[model samples]
Target: MAESEAILAAWDAYSDRHSDADGWPLDEVAYGWRMVQRDSETWRAFLPVRPGARQLLATAAFQLQHLSAGDIAPHWPSHLRDLNQALDRLEELRRGHAEVREARRTSGPVSQEKFIDSVAERNEEAWGYLDTWAAKGHVLLDVHAAAYKAPVRWVPTPAPTTVPARRAGRHV
Candidate 1:
């Protein structure tokens, strides 16, 4: 129960941090170019560059799924076009950012030029749409999270076995 609240709080904080853009300088934020960018809908954090923007697509997947649920906002479908457009932009930006990094790596430190463009632009653009959607349906997250809270799993680790006799297959 507590853990679920923590998760919801963390998710809200993250969404706020990434989407607020009040004092954040989109140009200076390395998240767009240097670090991986996460979309608001997915509720994920920084991820690494990957093949074909799988993480990039996850935003649309989550949004689409949430819309399909039909219990969120009364007008979730209104955001579908924007979400799809954001998906396209995100995919392009991610691919371009990856290519830029590859170019910089191969061209040696001397090559000041990179294949990267205004990554922040695409990132902010995508999040702008997502933020609008989230703001419109802000209640959904809280209500859903509270309603469907799951039990926290506790994984216990085995004690250390530094001694040879303590080995699993050895002297019991």
Candidate 2:
């Protein structure tokens, strides 16, 4: 199976195994796991250039799934919409910053610009929405913890060839 499929399978297995630990029924845990995995996949796919916005989405996803499973009714769609708008703005700002950066890099001694400031503003707005949504329900991440961990994989290395020997017990 592919790596994503394997990861998902593992996650499913883990959730099933741990379903009893939670105070909910088996179906609730399964549903929550699926929701978390779906959002995780979405954020993993779209990781924006915005600094904290991506993390905000990740934390929101986890918290929403957890809350939903725990019988909490949250306005997840409205929250997601707010974050989505902020992400769009951040993306625009990020593109502008990149263009400015490239222009300065190609040219020489360009005047200082508000690239960092633009990024800060966009990122701050996105984070603000995230914070607001978290206040209404739950925040999966702590102040110091990052909301997401980018997916990574290991590749196998080729084995070295051995020299030929005339006999197993005796050398030529």
The lDDT values for all models are 0.45, 0.49
TM-score of each: 0.34, 0.33
Top TM-score: which candidate number? Answer: 1
What clash pairs does model 2 have? none
Candidate 2 lDDT, 1-172, residue by residue in tens: 1333444456567666656666444687566546455434433333432366667667666645444233432455465656566566646655766777787789775656465444444444443333343342222242113223322235688886986657668855
Deviating ranges (above 4 Å) for candidate 1? 1-73, 110-172
Per-residue lDDT of candidate 1, residues 1-172 (tens digit):
2332344456456555655357553455553432224432222321232243344345434544543343444444454455445445656666776776676678666243323234444455555444433443333344345334533335799988784455567553
**Looking at candidate 1, what is the lDDT of residue 123?**
51
**Model 2 residue 27 CA deviation in Å:** 61
Summed over model 1, clashes come to 0
List the pairs of residues colliding in candidate 1: none
